[model samples]
Target chain A: MPKQVDHRERRETIARALWRVVEQRGIAHASVREVAQEAGISHGAVQHYFATREEMLVFAMDFASEQTSLRVAERVAELGDAPHPRDVLRVTLTEMLPLHPEARATSRMSAAYVLEALHDAHIHARAREGLTHGRDLVEDLVRQAITDGHIDPDRDPAIETNLLLALTGLTPLVELGVIEPREATTTIAHHLDRLFTNRP
Target chain B: MPKQVDHRERRETIARALWRVVEQRGIAHASVREVAQEAGISHGAVQHYFATREEMLVFAMDFASEQTSLRVAERVAELGDAPHPRDVLRVTLTEMLPLHPEARATSRMSAAYVLEALHDAHIHARAREGLTHGRDLVEDLVRQAITDGHIDPDRDPAIETNLLLALTGLTPLVELGVIEPREATTTIAHHLDRLFTNRP
Candidate 1:
């Protein structure tokens, strides 16, 4: 069991190294050697964990997504038990945006991976899984808001969920300085306000 | 004048070849040599038009955006004079989505260029310009809609414009099969219906 745990920990370290390389030099430069150097390990040692650069990139992407999810979970947990659906959503979606420096880096990495998905079936499947999971979570919260009379019952939970997800798609604009982070947050709040019009 | 025209046309041909390279083989494979082969020209010929791969890429990105804009303009023109703001908006927005194969390929190319924009300042500036221009056009239409009493006056035209632009950000999801193209169009229509609620 300890051996297995060590194996997982080693992989995580390598993934972290890959992320650092991606953040510092861009995904295009995140080769096995570069990541190995970033991790302060031998290139073969890195390959022991990830045989190919694609494999390493995929693991790093999953690791980054998991980290984001954990951060979102922490923020949501701060709301205490039985928090409002609106607050839960706001926290999750805001974390997903590239508003802050760290989130901005993560968003850039995600953008690169999405493009990579076009050429790599494994990456595409992973991206699809992440998108579907995010959609399901948001859809559930939207449905709960409706049931609790926080939002209008007539609103289609599915459509509302998709719109909210789509709204976060503006992260690139925010990153490009075309949309200010404050304005992006405001737009989210505005959209939420429209949806939660029935709040009592 | 003839010589100038030929120069411009030759560049266009090279850019088109770059697009074909990107469409068939993801942007990573879109080297000057590959594009030259695609264009049925010598590597030196492509170099004659674009001294570097980066220069070629920037030109190709601009070319693609211009093509998309022209297509959108043509679609909008089909609405004829004084088309209702809603129809104009719908046509423009729908045209932006990757609902069809050509649009989908273009969307993939755009996604790749967006990631490239992270590393290349020229591409980033171009992306910002495109985003800003798109935002301005949408904002104007939203303002006109308000003036015409198509949408409620209470809505902030800027925010509404950002939301609509952000909504098209879901092109990646649709490409990943996380959302059907049909479902995406429905979401757009549904959002439009909500915005145009004040329609008489």
Candidate 2:
């Protein structure tokens, strides 16, 4: 058996290759052989990490989601202690959009997964879980803002959360060139201003 | 030479078969042969209408979108001349969601196209056009509501249009059973209430 570190490294390498294939072609075209060729590894090596194509795709999806979460965490850390509630909410939500080239791939994977989830139960559950987690995060922030007097106490946090997170649904339009990334960001900022009661 | 009526009828038949294939097995598995088999027509007949696979897919997408629009128009016609703005907005947006069995297929196809648009230039353009059209419809509705004093005039019509239509983004989650269709409708109604100043 390989050591733990080697096993983790091999899996990471395979997942990255899978993402590249998914990014270049649609997920439908990301066959095991395609990923193997992209990774410069044998099909057997790729199988050693993920026995089935579904397994590989699921792992890659989770990995892409984790990468986004990590980036958000890093950005929050850079904001230092006591970041404004609106600023934190803005940064976190903006990170979810495909505003940057680096984020475009993950956003694409996510959009692909939404369709896949329609046909597959397991993928559906994972996609649902990811969306729920995102909603919960935004809801928490909205609740904090309300408590901090940044937003109206009369507003329903869940509805606000849903509305705010739904804006990320425009991510595909941004990616498809229907709207500019800057336009999406501007829309988000505009909505945020409306949500906050006391604007600086 | 085929008559104009025959040309239109044949294309519509082929497009319906293509939609069935897409609904059953997803857009990736929708091949010309599969669509032909489903339509009970010869492969040559299918080819006579659509010389290429992309042409067939694009036609089916437009057909499906048109079907949804027709449904919306029919629904609005039934609502009489004095329909409230909120009711009009709710019904229009609800029609876009995959809340019914009939709509689930079109919703799935739309979701699949979001991924396809990422890799195909022609599809990207068509998808962009559809999104822009949807946004415009919603924006126009918001403007009318503001003018009628149904909503606050201070709200940015474009931003409100974006946020309202973005709720349709939750359609996938509803289709996947992550949330009930009723919950989505409820959320839509909740937001509409928040938008209107004098909710009875």
Candidate 3:
């Protein structure tokens, strides 16, 4: 009897390989052959999952999104019901940034996909979807803070949330050794202090 | 005799061509042949200028730095002596961010070079040099603000200046259409208001 291969498992394995390659090689060498070599699978088998380079790239981006979203959801669940908006914002944003190795890999992959977004419409939509989703989640948290009276009633949630998200997403620069991590922490604390106005 | 070439002028023209190509196609396609085609010059002519891809990339990055530095100096000169610290900070930062096409092109080329920095040491140094120079300029401005009594004495100039430079560098996300320009401008204005309390 022929051996059965789990296609889904194979795809995940390939995506993990893709992330590893992108993390180390900066996404320029992430060809199917390269990923296959990294995954210890045959090139033909990898292609059996992704038909084109774009297909492979799109799949890799979606995988990154799923991984990040899962991590965010898990962290949120641990906060229990009606968590503080500030904590929610901190966890979600920090998770998205490249503070540690895992986050850095994800961030590097994100940078790759974002550049791809400029050239490919499918990747562009996926990149936009991920960013919009992140913005909405953070926006809702800001809205909750308003309802809970943790901030001034007069504060514009949209503009404030945009600041939070942009500032938060910048941690990757720290990981790149461009900005000192200590400085990024201090800067973030300063902004967060001004943003909530009523932090406990 | 072959046509006489001014080496300095030829290099500048090639650098401009590289920027135009990088502006159009992300740096991944910024190969010598492609750049030569964009410049309407022979590939051999381009090769006569840059022996390798890294050579070409480094030239491009230096060109970007020179362009940005020139713009910053011109803006600062317009402010004259004893300029308000707030205005000085605002002008230096707004010039760095991608609020217009010229700034956007520089920012896009920057994002391209930054990824390459991960794998190329020469490109890495160029990126770091540009960033460090920007930080030093902003830090001096921040220090001047302190002397001018525009901000609280207790504020740490290092941390605050780090915040200012990092936050300002991120406006390209606005140019990417990820964030609305209006929102970015408002958020930046809010931060500046807090940074320099004694504004004009």
Question: TM-scores, in order shown?
Answer: 0.95, 0.92, 0.90
Model 2 chain A: weakest 10-residue lDDT segment is A171-180
* Candidate 2 RMSD computed on C-alpha atoms after optimal superposition onto the true structure: 2.5
Q: Write the per-residue lDDT of candidate 2 for residues B1-200, one digit (tens) a residue.
A: 56988998899899888777777777888889999999999999999999999999898889889888888888888899988888888888888888776577677777777778878989989999998887787889899988888888888787777777778877766765656777788878987887787544
Error of 1 at A182 (Å): 0.8
In terms of TM-score, the best-performing candidate is 1
The local lDDT score (0 to 100) that residue A84 gets in candidate 1 is: 78
For this target, which candidate reaches the highest DockQ against the unseen true structure? 1
Off by over 4 Å in 3: A1-5, A77-81, B1-5, B77-81, B168-172
Count clashing pairs, candidate 2.
0
Q: What would the per-residue lDDT of candidate 3 be over residues B116-187, giving only the tens digit for each residue?
A: 887777777777877777677778878878887888777778877766766654553564477877667777
Question: What local distance difference test score does each model get?
Answer: 0.83, 0.81, 0.76
Candidate 3 chain A lDDT trough over 10 residues, lowest sum: A1-10
- lDDT (tens digit, per residue) of candidate 3 on A1-200: 22245776678789889988988787878899999999998999999999987888888778787888888778888999978777676667667777778777777888877776776777777678777777787788788888888987788888777677667545435645767766676677776777789776
Report residue A154 deviation for candidate 1 (angstroms).
1.2
Q: Mark the regions of model 1 whose C-alpha exceeds 4 Å error after superposition.
A: none
